[model samples]
Target: MFWATGWKPIVLAAAMLLASASSALAEEGVPTPGDLLAERLDERLGEQEVALQAFYAARDGRPAWQETATVAALANALRTLDADGLTPQDYRPDTLVAAHRQALAEQSSPAARARFDVQTSQTLLTALRHLQRGKVDPYRIDPGWEVPIEAPPLDLAAISQAVDARRFEQAFASARPSSASYERLRASLARYRHIARQGGWPMMPPRSQSLRPGELHDDVLLLRERLAILGELEVMAAGVSAGVEPQATEPRRYDERLVAAVERFQQRHLLEVDGIVGPRTRAALNVPVVTRIDQIRVNLERARWLLHGLPDSFVLVDIAGYRIRYFRPDGDVWRSRIVVGRPYRRTPSLRSSISHLTINPTWTVPPTILREDVLPRVRRNLGYLWQQDLMVLSPSGRRLDPRDVDWWRPGNVILRQRAGPRNALGRVVLRFPNDHLVYLHDTPAQALFAREQRAFSSGCIRVQGVLELAQHLFDDTGTEAEVSTLVAAGRTRNVHLERPVPVILHYWTVHPDEEGRLVFRPDVYQRDAALLEALDASPTR
Candidate 1:
């Protein structure tokens, strides 16, 4: 094989040094370097011993990390792991470099060289595995996560080939997620870390009253400085004048410009865009830059969890963001606000494909909702069933009188709402098969979508402009009209799509907007704390 010219001489020099080391070891009555390397591989590598052994066996049990250029490249790769929201100390690049230098100095000791070689290989493999999948498993952190974590199996052969070819950087890059969203978040992480290094924005003092436009308050000055540091405000220099006299208290006044900047900040944080700075807005602005950095890191870990091998087209439900985006092949995207499950009835993260759409769909209350929601209402007044247009049915699909059934111990019965304006599920329903029985559908309560934090559903997602989304998903010109006709006819009809579009119901507290700016959302499910705890924990391996 032809090695790259840049490192060919270094490889030859390392081979010669290895030969000299082996000859010296033989003179001292010690085993050959390859034999010692095989022994060290067995002792150091617990679960990965077989793979490392097989990798070395292909090269006649020779040490692969003898070349200084290869080890340096591995060290560089480990150092840059921080850019991916990974801790560089976890890989211990400095220790690896120091060990390599010491091994080179003691060229006569095959044992030292063998140990360094094994350590280098093990560290490289671990780093690659973490980059490809993640440091922590999703199932371990989130027991309710249902999305299948798909990652390419670790190929030691390919890694060895890359190291031999001296393409370590390219290999590490290929291991990470390739989606634009992941890359954007990675860039934001770097910027936020830089802000931390520069002593992040100052905290604003608490105030009981909201800061409205054209009002004067001392806290507004601190708010302006905070927003200015975040690039949301354009602050003129202290002495720079634009023909207007600068008053001492002018900055403290809640001017229109500062209000606009606050609105922008509120928009990015997924808070209400009102021009007034209320408690919620103040709380968001007062969040420490270090916390925001950690938020970016946590979401970066989340991006690694689900961004691999995405289809050409798919529907992504940003649960925490309270929004849905349907991505198409031609780069066109359709988006709408959505109401996800409440915090206690948290929406699960899963991947499924939308195969069909139901026009004028009926609503069936799930078991949990029935026990926790409907039973209480019905037990108080049997008239509640009639008010909600819910019909009680036996397990055999036989209709039962609501008055005769015992609401307290209603066993083996179903509560279904007929199709109408009062139905919980509105005019159209997008159906996908999953164990959770949660699907995206139109809701009668459209007012909920207007709220910034839309987490009102039992477990299913209530989508705004769902009919339009159904039109996009249909992907068939004729089926769109058919769906409209069925809905207008007020008849229950299921229309299968010509091509099933993949759907991913995901939870992300931070994601990049269209302009590539990071948008932070409330962790409504309170998932980030647990995930961050797991991520910061020591590696299980």
Candidate 2:
């Protein structure tokens, strides 16, 4: 709104003239026009007053938007903010363009020019800040978010200098997260936006029976069209080539080629590769293109939150996607499936370094798991303790018989499982320091890893192929033989790493796959709604 209007030319000119003359006419030093304009800018910058004042003072109170090329560069940058999943309207690009035009008009006044300068600077600074850190502070919305997003302090003086040198484009590029993942998501956003502009893909009608290969149905036409729109299907030009009849071109028939395309679609969506049009696959297909666009946008903001300042090599736990990746410095990446916490006991997002690994680890049942999970089953049957190979211990480290204790009030006593084949933490535990006390470990319940949506753990992560991951973390420190011996002997041991590897336990419902295509996962913890609400709200200064 500040850049929407201009002051009357005659009155503003007369005030400027009087203010300039007052410098010569002052008995008690009157403020000049530039000083008055600076005062106006300070008043407009509420909390940012100090930084902005320093910015202008370094330039001797001169306007930063004097150059037409600089202004045009900034305007162009603001217009393309949508590529970064930012709403251009939030930065007032239309108002900026209009005000810039008015400032360059024949009857423009100094007041109008000063307003344009202050408002344009504020808009650019806000956009840059959002691009650097994020529009929403993740902690404000989700208190359990523990990843440190310490925004780098803004050096307004340097920014002012860059603008003066007409290096606004370079400054903006430097402000954004420079990760390949971010760039891929931006490209995916553009593709999805283009899909939406073309009226999106068609939705198929509901059917009772599952559609398999060699089936003929009217809804197959919609399915073919939908898959083709998403580039998952290659529509054959109306001619047979190999192992095909002329009727294979019929849209109503679900032939072998269609089955292959369906498998590809399933793979992209992380669904079963059976190629049958079942309920889950159908639901995935019917998701509107606009909704997919928002999914990419939401993940773009997420990428902004944590993609910067990464170490050369670290482990990334993609909670929602049920996978973890180990990035090596030599551009090699190792990945495996994982089982994260369930919805009710949602795993927290955090950053910490893996300090060491515990081999043949025993499970000291956490308090919450003891109360809600173990005690209930033990109360139903006292033999549950023996079945689980758990030992009951007193507060003073003395072993107690389960039959001698009261199941109704097992106060202060600890339940620890012996290190064995049936132990909950199978053979290894990757420990990290955090208030939540969760870690990555091997699980005997490896069947859960086969699930498409693996959220079965209490809070800690159960990793598949954990031994391979531990060996990689060791980084050829010659401890592989010792680890194997200790694990085979069933002896408890802690193996400190040669150097601690950083680990980030994060949640993301959309991310790029190995091929750089976007993979949309389910919002298992229902976090997207709150974040989407915060992002859609009017931005703050």
Candidate 3:
């Protein structure tokens, strides 16, 4: 009886248990945790060779995250992945923890524990990938979007070291994005989820037409409630409901205040700023709160892709919003209106460095543009080339007469436009070394910037204040006076940058406005639905 406190019985008991475990493992053909983990890796994911090799190569054949304390830590971490808009079921941390407990109780086999340990390592890897690069492959969602090759796996051996007691949570968190914009969106996502849990905003009843500002109908009451829940309508007091109109005076009246609120909502949605709710405004307002919640979630996924390792100075182009923002380390240096690709020809998400700037740039139409756009126009009017200040060049770069060529037939003749004020590529062009052959340049059509939705380009982006952008890029090389002189000279000039600035062209339908109110834009190319569907199918990783 007193042997409970003695060391001899304990040592013998441990020896017997080890002998039994060894016999059982040999019977199962898995002698150690490493052998079981390897067997599970081969059985479950034969194609995940890279992850498997990376996972085991670091641990010297031991389970890095499969130990009891480590797995419990991972379980706690996995439970909170929803805070970052991730699905907890994707990791199945509860099942892993439960199985580990079963193994400790001798109810589960060593194989089960080995399987849990292997998958937990895989879960860490997959979750890290998600935190760094987004859930779905951006290129698969939209072929125009550029996605880099898979980055090397993290140093899991170091992360799982006993000396570093941060566990999976703190260790894996090192891969998360650390940007202010991402943080702000994360905060907004939490608030929106809270709103969702509270039953979200009410759905507006369908009417044949929209409710005007001055009309006094029951639909107007619903609209008031809708705007109040959307945070557009300002309440009179903390306790008072913003949706409630003043009682005993005018229960059914569209006062100027309501009209103003409607206008604000329209502005938030990039709709026509008319106080009256028309069909377009009505359609926007009728979008369900759940749909907006999904929109926020979709954009949050995109935010993860661009969150980390950004340059000190860079440019961000919001494709759907038709805006460009230049940033330094501190804040936005400048912002300009931009025209992105049309519905058919969308501007793709790109991440590239601006290597050089081109002044008095010439426009050479791409083959696709020539085949689709120029050919049709030329077939109609033979004088299109002369009118548009364009010329035809043969294969050898010699000028050719359009009269001698057949406009109906397809050929590889290049269309070159001269460098001038009316040139398609206005004064300066910021060139990125890419295979896509798309560059940011100026445009003469300044009036288009005044419109809310500006998806008017073929594919290349057209900048409003392109001169300022050029001058900004030419920071140490030259001055505004020098660039102005160069532009006036009318000769083609290519100026190299001392240090290239990074440029990212991305798309997002929802973002917070200046006042931190969520604003939405039209899915110009109808991309949101496709992306949402892709996200629905993106859980395999």
Question: All candidates' lDDT scores?
Answer: 0.82, 0.83, 0.75
- Model 2: per-residue Cα lDDT over 19-133, one tens digit each: 7687685546666656665665555555455656666777777788756677877877788889889888898776666678888676865567777787787788778888888
Across 1-541, the per-residue lDDT of candidate 3 in tens digits comes to 5666678788899999988897898898766644655565445444455866566666655555445776677778878877776777777777876767765465655456556656666777777777767777877767667735333446666655631363656665665676666666677778778777878766666677767766877666667777776677774312134477554425446666778988999888888788887778878887876787778778878777776666677888888888898886456578888999889888878888888878898888888888889889999998898888888999889999899998887477889888887888899998997667888998878888888889899888999888887777776334333577778888898878777788888888987766677778898888788777776663764
Q: What's model 1's TM-score? A: 0.87
Candidate 1 regions exceeding 4 Å error are: 1-62, 101-112, 152-167, 236-249, 476-481
lDDT score, candidate 2, position 297: 83
Against the hidden reference, what TM-scores do the models get? 0.87, 0.87, 0.82
Candidate closer to the true structure by lDDT (higher is better), 2 or 3: 2
Write out the backbone clash pairs for model 3: none
In model 1, what is the error at residue 504, expressed in angstroms? 0.6
Better of 2 and 3 by TM-score: 2
Rank by TM-score, descending?
Answer: 1, 2, 3
RMSD of 1: 5.4
